[model samples]
Target: MNVEKIYQGTADKVLRGIPASSGIVLGRAVVLRNEIFVDTHKTIQNEEIESEIKRFDIAKKNLVAEFEESISHIPPNAKDLKAILQADLMMVEDKFMYDSIIKFIKELHTAEAALVIVFDQSKQLLKHSTDELFRERVTELDNILKRFIIHLSKGEKLSEISENTIIIAQSLTPSELLKLIEKKVTAIVTEVGGITSHLAILTRSYSIPAIISLKNATHEISANDEIILDGYTGHLFINPDLTLYKFYREKQKRIAEHIKELGELIGLPCKTKDEKPIQLWCNANNIDDVKNAKIVSSPGLGLVRTESLILSLNRIPTEKEQYDYYKTIADTAYPMTVTLRAFDIGSDKYADNLLIHEDNPALGLRGIRYLLAKKDEFKIQLRAILKASKHKNIRLMLPMITSLEEVIQTKKLLEECKLELLNEDETFDHDMLVGIMIETPAAALIADDLSKICDFFSLGTNDLTQYCLAADRTNESLSEFFNSFHPGVLRLMEFTVNAAHKNNIPVAVCGEMASHPLATSFLIGMGVDELSVAPSLFLEVKEKILDSSFKQCQKNVSKILKTAMLKDIYQSMDV
Candidate 1:
């Protein structure tokens, strides 16, 4: 119901900008801006100076954390984001700059006010610089700090965003763009960011329709304004006429036809060329995804991200609230089954009480670790999941499992929840399955032991590859090293899959590896019992396996397993 049909989408009044990505898209607009304007100067009381300085220090620390979080979002424009990020820090740490800020704070200005004065003075000095690099850095520094200011302002604008939407911003960062991409934002327009800058080139690499350097785009484009963007020509039209509307609407249909074609394959029997049946499941985080999965006729959900369903409010949801939410999806996919993973918090995500500062969050308390640490909250979650299992179709999955000891501990807790539900006379499924996500090297290394104690294993290849290769995708220096097809990563997958099968348990590839074009057939050959992917790519992945003979896939897997180079991995799976 939140979805807007793009067929009626159009644009009338035109505005010119720099074409960043080459594509055409029509959709509604969502304008993003900072809640606190940078230019505002607030005089602080002399007595409040101490607290103000502390606030500034905290904000500066948060600024660095923001930059670190952007690591995973480095774009095509910044081929070496690690170095670029270092340069950004050096600019902020300049002696004269931080000194000027302190000087302003002594003059009784707020932290943001002090920053603005120093920033303007610095820019004035560089205004006439003949060095092109100096001129460019000035612009980069301003954009980076302004975004940090927005963070300091703490405005997360309405969390409810719909599909086929275009984002217009005073300025945008590659990290911001990546987050929106996850929500299926159709296009982008921004007042700042150059065609060669990090934000612009990223849009190009992602094949999204976008334009940059559109002056005052955040003001010119209002929210919900139906607009047409010609990314090839750097033009945006607002409130388009019937004629232009019809033209773009027809073009939109032609473009969407290919995607629609893919969905048609979903209803067909899923199997390999040899008639070996395989399960193709879809992943969902909300109602829209559930609806899309239903349309594609996904057999069931392989991953139900419970956090996304509840954490948008950044608070702990009540047990009834969690039950209603999970029950909706479980009932919708009834007959088939839905696997609801417990709140996988940590990293960039937090749920109220779970919010805490960590120098390295990704490797810190997250996923099942967070849940086990917060046992009372964990019980509320388990009880809700159990309460929703009245249809006998909802299962529980634990993420970030690193040991059989953790599995035993979780199993003990799950049993407690089941008993509580029975004592309360709650209607529930007693046979609900519990599984562990084999994401860590430690977990995969002990998959044989885990299989003996767990109902199933879901290979979270994204984390597995990162852990196995000791590579972080955000660190551009390790771009080549952060490969999903690295031999070691693949070997781990094979080892875990074999362990699960030998123990008479099912194994699934539920990460991006399942949906990768080359990896799909190879995974099929590797003998994973199921492949779980986003609903949008469900049918396409299913078709990839259907076109592959099990024998050929087995052969491809055999050849690729022995390859030493990345190029050879591709060649082995080339056919």
Candidate 2:
């Protein structure tokens, strides 16, 4: 039911949060208390309005100049990092955002208050989005605003960080993060960062162990205090006892050695001890994911969620825009397979118009049901995916599919789009493989029917675990109830794999469980052909997989599945 590593020794305290990166590190805690600013009703005098507007303009110009300088200093090889900096710069110079701020300033609001109005307005709109990507955009924009405030407040730049310093911060701006990377801070702990947030993603790209969403991080961990950060397990051991300190010290040493060897795994086939070829597909949700996972040879993107690209521009993108965006992704991971899962939006994702209020939208209209209900809109996405598939490596996957009919209708629409493209003489992959996500209970129950249609089956166990258990994983109280390794869930996974195999189709686990360290061996035993793992977890998952043998894991699965208790199932996989 849980994979957190619990040490048997005492420590001053161990704080648990979500891991942003993966590694074990012992460092001097360097508390970074950035000045916090909030929206206020403070109004500038009429005479101060023009000066405030000019101050705002000057701040924007300075921030833009900082991004440009950073981008320039970036070597030619780090194109992705440079591109990220450029994107932040674009946000700094966004015309609409700038104009709105100016209008607020003209209303006599101070430059700081003007920023608050504009940033809050934009963030509030995106917060209503059901998509995680859209919600994460709020964090990205928050960083942009932080930069602006720092410039306007006449704040000093970050001081140089010494080696092996664990950064404890309230929240980090993008520029501060870049500077920390330059200084090579040992670890990062932030009070307000989600796993998908910009700060967390950037930390992982640099391979620094990070614990985000760690409340009271700055208050508890003072500068120069010795600490152990467990990014692999989401625990921060602050001022630990001697025993705990020694354990983590050795643990850090072992992890460093393992990470060093993981680079050698690049270009090498991921086969188990028994020589069972294990296909590890990376989840390329963003450019950073692609860049981090690009080290692996012939790296296939198991899941490419298109929610951000669809919703980012504040309007639904044209087919051409989607094509250009998707094509760049496929081209970046060129020649390697890219499984494009069409918008999995529902009330839980970005479905503003799809549903107003339902008792429960997850169980209601979402996924394939939502797409099917909006065929015309769905066709646009389908055509864009198809058009982007001219590379011949792109395949389509349907999310939240529970029926044979949904797959049939989706395929029919896809064919119609293909015909339209053909008529227009536009190039696309006619033979692109189509798949379905086995995330619903009904889908698993009728895997035989679904397998008959789908070229592949990707078990989205994150949702499957939630739906099968009838527990909302997001609901904190339901945490203990949402166990993915439960026998019932295991049976569904086994059944789907069997069905896919019966139809001679591949089955990939594209859910959180796929990359989960404890579940790696169990999944390998269950006979899933591929695991679409988070790139950040790639090294750790690879290490576990290499230590496992298919025959041993299969035998273990047979014994583990026969047990009905979740505790026993987890205990068996704990090894």
Candidate 3:
């Protein structure tokens, strides 16, 4: 007699992966269980050692060429892929990895085993390293190995474990993850990573449902097991009951409908029901993001982070390259305003061979300080922005400005750059507007004085809230004080906006605070002229603003300011 399986056992020790993006997907699990193998050709005669070494050299050259060729075909629109290729090339040329491979080949007596041993050892080191910097280095090394392996395996028999699969692996490098086309792989689940990890960022970029840090996911999930993945709520159900299945099926239908509705909003004006027009803008890091902004009908680009371009290149981008990049976005946005912020680098984002230890990096030497210290580099960026402004609507903004003196010095530097350009007969937009980000309390309090010199102000509430409340949002222990609606924060914002308006300067809010549905109304009432948020949240925020009244927001702000403590203000307001 034959029997059919109805249910599987419960996953008692199952660890769940953190969802990076949202969607429900069901598919067979493809287990890419990789094992190192050594392919040894027949032993060459003693006299062939010189020829063997030459062959290994040729193989290395050909391998690198092949990788470059494949990378060239990756869409220029894929910023994540571009970043991975940049990092991978660095790894291939790293002295440490190269020396290890050479030593292995000389001692191990075969090129194939030598390569495998070097890769295996590097992988082991990556798994064991406690230092984050070392771990990142190892991750890059593993990327090189995986790419080389895949390059060799091309056109060969690839064991397809299943069709319409979800990839379950220990951890996937960016290159490996990119190689899997979206149609075949429904989702990606890994055993390690936080939201900022490369794989997580890439998954979010592609709008794919990904779950990370699921310990032993590869061991627990069996091939071809019908499972339900809830990316929104980070839930996984294995062989769910009939009732649960029906509920998820209904949920899938609702999600599809909602997405369709959001699609309809594309290219529509982001105006409130009362005819209050809000400038819906997109935060971009590269030209691809600029293109995405056009698709979403973002009226402008709020924050053009230039760090992505700098990090992707082997060396700092030349003035001409930077000019072209900035110009591309400005020309694309055309009449819409494009605000480009100077490089914001510090602890985690330090340039090569320049290290600075800080007890609290968020408050340490970053943003303007880093830029000022490297005057030449800072001037180059300013020159690029000035040149780009000649063709498009461009605004230059300084980040992490805490004092009036920093603003004065930055303005002076800009003047010097302008004068130098004039001497070189290169015409620039001398009348380009300059702005400063009010992220610190000191900056907020002195906005009146700063506004006298600067053209505009943008409130970075993410750091401002953290600084005011003396709470690190990353620390779960301080979760109670991370509230943005707190009386203290609201009061500061009110003061900053009032100060800017008092001096006849426009103010905008560009942070997580601006994207919140309830907070958007409050900000507009606080006398802010603009609210810049991500493109994905544009329609929802617009809907919220249309449903709300500016009059009510002002009334709520007044009530909150009268309260004594931050917590009391939050309790009084509905938000």
Which candidate number has the best TM-score? Answer: 2
Residue 57 alpha-carbon offset, candidate 3, angstroms: 8.7
Q: Which candidate model has the greater lDDT, 2 or 3?
A: 2
Candidate 3 segments exceeding 4 Å error: 1-19, 28-73, 100-161, 194-196, 213-225, 233-239, 274-276, 346-365, 423-426, 438-453, 459-575
Per-candidate TM-scores read 0.63, 0.80, 0.71
Q: List the residue pairs that clash in candidate 1.
A: 11-240, 12-240
Which candidate model has the greater TM-score, 2 or 3? 2
Q: Candidate 3 at 531: error in angstroms?
A: 4.3
Q: Residue-wise lDDT of candidate 3 within 234-278, one digit each (tens)? A: 556665667657877899999888777876677666655556666
Question: Model 2, residue 528: what's the lDDT?
Answer: 91
lDDT of 3: 0.70
Candidates sorted by TM-score, best first? 2, 3, 1
lDDT of each model, Cα atoms only? Answer: 0.75, 0.80, 0.70
- Which sections of candidate 1 miss by over 4 Å? 1-260, 347-358
RMSD of each predicted structure: 13.4, 4.7, 7.8
Per-residue lDDT of model 2, residues 402-517, tens digit only: 88999999999988999999999989999999998999899999998888888999999978987899875543345557778778899989988988899899999987788777
